[model samples]
Target: MPATVFSCRWFALCALLLLGGCQPDQPAPPLDQQLYIWQRQWRPAHEQALSASRADFSTLRVLALQAQPKAGWSRARVDLAQLKADGRPVIAVIRLDGQLPALDLDRARAQISQLLADWRAGGVMPTGVEIDHDSGSARLSGYTDFLIKLRGLLPPSLKLSITALPAWLDSPQLPALLQAVDSSVLQVHAVSNPRLGLFNPGQPRDWAERWGRVSDKAFYLALPAYGIAVLPDDGGAPVVESEVALNRGGERRELLADPQQLATLARQLRAKPPAHLAGLIWFRLPLPGDRRAWSLSTLSAVARGEALASQWQVQLSARDGLYDIRLDNLGNLDRPLPARVELNAEQCDGVDGLSGYTLRQTPKQLIFTRQSSARIAAGGQRALGWARCTRIDQGAWNVYP
Candidate 1:
């Protein structure tokens, strides 16, 4: 070959290599492995749990702690060092107050920039930044403009994403908003009152199909890994509250998706996801001792389409001739266990702990029957009603499914 031809070939090859090097790393091809870390504190237990479940997760979206806006934005506490050491792609999340003044965009931007700078100075580099805002449709234009400006300010190498509302999915500015970010997380779980249900399989499926038809940008469907408590108002209206209140009092119902239900949903989405639907991002990364939320094992089991096992334990106490039996569900999945409880005690007359349940004296035992709409929650317990017995001992009790 001529010297000029050989030189041209070498130059082309060098150019190709340079281009390839300059290209941003294509994100790990949308995996079934992503979780959101909303907790402000990163405990050793959290680290251990993450380490154990590390193989199941490819990305960790950590929330950048922020307090109520007074005059300017203030950084909240975050485990930046731990997050960096986790050895996974991290997405720093800035949860903007939904009620933030629209006029304070510039100030907010400056505060966010400072946060980014601090993250960099601290040696914590995130592959992306996610803006979590619940702005309404009317605020779409402002939100979109803010995102545009944010994109301009963000480093070109880093991607930008947002947690999108289902309401905004139908807005005309949605496409423009999506265009401003490299990817978005469409949360399809909390469409209705969580009190009604944590998630309805059909709602997410329908929304995913609809969203898939609309935009072609990369996205993930945020699913619930947590449970919520729904208390009835004086007027019988369902009011959703945090799980903490469930222990306080009142007739509140705890809502959570069954593991089987979640597994089925996962299978459905995996089999037929939207063109842009990347994968599922669980609402939370479960830590050890997080009773209100599904554990890492449960999440893994659901992802693998496996059934969750139920463990039940009963504790008996006696006071004032009344035997109190507490039935606790020590399982991961919220499921109905055998409500018919049989006690090996004679002359057991009346019972009082659970409402809508009846105790009948059989020839050999006392059988407690559960009424309709009665179910046990995982890691939760219900009183089996006090039984009027002559003596309370470690009597053999059997719970029938």
Candidate 2:
């Protein structure tokens, strides 16, 4: 054999080895997704929201009933006709007030039974029943007993599930509680102090690891795709204002989950999924006119581990000295409306803005300002204002972050 031929073969082998080592990592497997339609009453918009989100979520968890401190009990007027029409696997969520003094097993059982009857009569049979009681750690033993009794009355074909809290991990009875149900949904959203905001990005990963070790059965994680408005503290518990109206006398601070951060977390969970971790469940599906929830495009992207972002652009149209200025979001995420928008115009007869914006005009400029933060939906545009001028150059505009 020639020395040159031997050297060439050796180099080729080395190149092949290098290529193998440099191959891209395997893509993470897709995770199953579910959504919680938590509105108390089913309106026209709920049907629209559900119809549009058919591709993103497989199962629907509807708010069926809720028990409050003094409100006795109120049932969710869920749209049965629509649910029957959609014909998707549904889970009815029954909420028990976390602050209740004791677990009234009899009352809760009655409520569950009646709810099942009502739903069945409407031709909307639920695949499972989930008790969303945020009971305390000390009450875990009692809660377990209640669940066992509740499970006894449920149909054999239907599954029993529970909405579990991270704090339950410290309780020794958590295993027993898990045993009473087929599967559990670990709610990692809005469990911490309201003053600390709704969710802590780093904390959920640690909690998930610990929960995975303790639970033997299949479980899913409940994540936040919505925001909460925290009313000013009045020396008592913070008021959480969701879709409900709160007439409390104080200012409200809006806190929302970051879509990009959540998207990254989803990717991490998929890349190295926890043991027995079934999938992800997004809390409270967003509707068409929902102000606190993320847009469907953004939520779907996060669920699929896609990059989250919104592209903001200034749209200016002029016809015979009448110019219409607007802000449009071209990307797939909702964008916070600009605090201030400034445009340099050569000459302006008059200028103004709309939707909580005031016009600030200078000799050669036009400005629109708003006091509170708002958002522009993906593929949606908002009218910033219009100007009657010779030329309102589209290129001479600045939008402040």
Candidate 3:
């Protein structure tokens, strides 16, 4: 070959190598979908949700399914066969109580070993094990020690993961602790203050950015799919209630979230994810009849980047001298439907079946509005109230936004 031609080829090769070396390595594709089953009892709704078209979860993180600390060792009850039949990889989660930090290392190791043995015996071996602990910053050292010991006990084939708190990232020991595990799940949701709202809009972005800069370990972000009630305390300050309270004949109040917020968060994460971020893990898998949670269709739509729209319908019916006003939500998103139905007082004498709703008498129309939380689920309907009419005129009834 000519000297000039040979020299040019060599230069081109070197340029290619330098460019490849300078370019950042692409991160591995994240887990497309994941969910945590915190409830012990497996309701039919759970099965239905799992089978639903929208629930295309690739992994199921089952909590407290097989193991719990008892006596000196751990007690386990895992149904490996059933889990295997679920047609997805299972990540068995073992919840540690406050007693974890106080337990003897040797005893803790033995209990964990026993738990694994129980799982193996039941043929329900997990693809990975996740330690769910909300260890405080002060307990970082202890938590790190526990993880290191746990890693030593875990089989080389099984991945060891943990549910990490944002607070842990602030600790200097975080990087070292992360090194001890194969992967970690950063719970970006539930960090919101009840006094503020069920969720903080900026939390996901803030945590992801912080985690990207500090940690080099692979991790997933856990987001919320459920609602929380913010009740007023004795001092009138807002406090988070344990759960949404409901009764057959009692007042009810709730603070429900719009799932679109989660979609917005997902978009932000996808647009700017941390270098080590793996994917998202929903705080829970919502099931049918879970009025307080997003429906499967809504979640799927959000995941697909589809906009959620509202659809409402109202109907009036009468039998004898009594009349009924019903409101329905036909949209994919759950919304607070119109709680008040207006009717001409000349046609309707009085209203009933609205125990928790208040009635207002205007000059021409009667307005019945809900006094508490009155949200309707997608495709769900509820009676606004019934009216006693001097003459039932269904055409005169109307619903307000």
Count: clashes, candidate 3: 1
The window of 10 residues in a row where model 1 has the poorest summed lDDT is: 65-74
How do all models score by TM-score? 0.71, 0.91, 0.77
Off by over 4 Å in 3: 1-31, 65-84, 98-103, 117-123, 230-240, 243-257, 288-291, 316-324, 343-351, 354-366, 387-401
| Per-residue C-alpha lDDT of model 2 across residues 1-401, encoded as one tens digit per residue | 99999999999999999999999978655678999989887888877888878888999999999999889888999989998888879999999989878878788888888998999999999999999999989889999999998899788899999999999989999989999999999999999989899988897778888888887898889999989999987788888998776888777899998887788788889888787788899987888778898998888878867776677788988888888888898878888888888888877878888877888888888988986688887788888888898777778888887
Per-model lDDT: 0.74, 0.87, 0.70
Which candidate do you rate higher for TM-score, 1 or 2?
A: 2
Clashing pairs in 2: none
* Per-residue lDDT over 1-29 for candidate 1, one digit per residue giving the tens place of the 0 to 100 score: 99999999999999999999999855444
Candidate 2: worst-modelled 10 consecutive residues by lDDT: 303-312
Stretches of candidate 1 off by over 4 Å are 1-30, 67-76, 232-239, 243-250, 307-397
